[model samples]
Target: MKALITGVAGFIGYHLAQRLLVEGVEVYGIDNLNDYYQVTLKKDRLAQLQDKPGFTFQFLDLCDRQGITELFQSHRFEYVVNLAAQAGVRYSIENPHAYVDSNIVGFVNLLEACRHSSIQHLVYASSSSVYGVNPKIPFAVGDNVDHPISLYAASKKANELMAYTYSHLFHLPTTGLRFFTVYGPWGRPDMAYFKFTQAIEAGTPIDVYNFGDMKRDFTYIDDIIEGIVRLLPLAPQLEDVNSLEQSTPQAPYKLYNIGNNNPVALVRFIEVIEAELGKKAQKNFLPMQPGDVPITYADVDDLMRDVGFQPTTSIEEGVARFVQWYRSYYG
Candidate 1:
């Protein structure tokens, strides 16, 4: 099978590409290589896949309508995975327009391309941030997500709506995966786990937001990739749509939360990092930041039932793996 993966240089994207390549799948990957985090790290991720067989890379932006259309016309992709987006909640608050251009306008261009290309299935990355102020203990796919606190969350929710519209109007098969806190080796430097590791290694104080009261469903990268691989062949069928409680009978669209059902406390997460690094962290507890949620607990019952798998990586093991990669890469 052939697949098109946007944001191929990203942490999750790179890992997904690697797994597909191992399974003898031809993968066409694209990335703008934006300096949102560190361009060097993205380049390094791409470097790993550059020499792999059945893998190709292109420097392209999702916002480029003409370029994207040309790409779709040139390659007949069976599956399209849209993981490229202007990520980060706090960054979205500072620059709302970035989210609009990438998450909204860019997404529209992708939908148009997919619709015209008649792609078999389109899987896109949705975030747990979309839950936004949801008081529910474990956020479910059927839960109401009308209130979004951050522009980032709003853009993701908008993507889900847009995908549903495409599925209903154009009969495009779409599936949205709401990812909880994903953490692992070669992960984003902007993530808390990475930052905390860097600070503790340097003997500096790590910033503990929400005064260490926050909790997150930190899912490992391997688990997330496994879930995606299993769902690729199980696209939403129009005939079986009614069986899905979260989907409409008329639309071939579905949404599922892929997360470790267990939520880890912020302090406990830091302790794992410290233990892995063999160093003590000087934590600077601070008030909750704007656009930050106190906790993110995902209810993955539907995902488990459909995929027969859910993220099961524990925080301790995941943190240790990340710390090993960080030390080896940075040393």
Candidate 2:
């Protein structure tokens, strides 16, 4: 079967597409090559998959209506995975328009294409940030995510709503995965882990937000991908609209929290990274900034119940693997 994966040049997209391709699945990938961080890194990722059999790529933007429709009409994709978006909470505060353009308008275009193409299933990326300012300890899929602190989070929430609409109106099989603090090799430099490694290696001070009091469910990339791979075949079956708490009530729609299910303190996470790198980091603790959350924990019972998903990688091992790849990639 053929799969069309958006944001194939992105960290998660690259890894997911690689996994599917290795499994002998035909994959068509696309990205606009936007200079969000460094286009070179994105290009480097795309280069790795260009020569693989059953792998093809296009330089296209989701906001381009005609482009998206034309591509969908031409390719017979059995599955559609939407991973492209304007990511980062802090950056969202600066360029809010980018989020609306890519995450909102661009997403609508993708949904339109899927609806017209009669795609079998659509799996899209959501963010834990959607549970903004919730006092809840571990964010659950059934929780109320009406308050989003950042535009990026709001756009993601909007995507979930839009997906449900398509599913209800067209019976489209749609699944949304709320990923939390995903990190590993070939990760984005804009992420905290990548930035921390860069600063620590250069003897620079690493910024610790919320005075190192924050907590996060730092999930490894492999674990997140495993959850997605398992859920790929578990399509929803549409039923009646009784309550909003039910995720997959036979309505051909579902949502799951793909996370470590263990929140690690920021200071502790940094300690693990330092231990792995065999170096001490110069820390610059700072108060929480706007559009930032104090903690993010995930209750992934639904994921486990449906797919037997469990995160087994510890921070120490995950950090060590990342450090090894960072040294070789940048040294």
TM-score (C-alpha, index-matched) for candidate 1 = 0.97
Which 10 consecutive residues of model 2 have the lowest summed lDDT?
Answer: 240-249
| Candidate 2 C-alpha lDDT tens digits along 150-267 | 9999999999999999888888889999999999999999999999999999999999998998999999999988888888877777763322765544467888888898999989
lDDT for 197 (candidate 2): 91
lDDT agreement of model 1 with the native: 0.92
The per-model lDDT (C-alpha) reads 0.92, 0.91
Model 2 residue 166 lDDT score: 89
Those runs of model 1 whose alpha carbons end farther than 4 Å from true positions after fitting are 239-249
* Candidate 1 lDDT tens digits, 150-202: 99999999999999889888889999999998999999999999999999999
Which whole-number lDDT from 0 to 100 does residue 148 have in model 2?
A: 97
Error of 1 at 306 (Å): 0.9
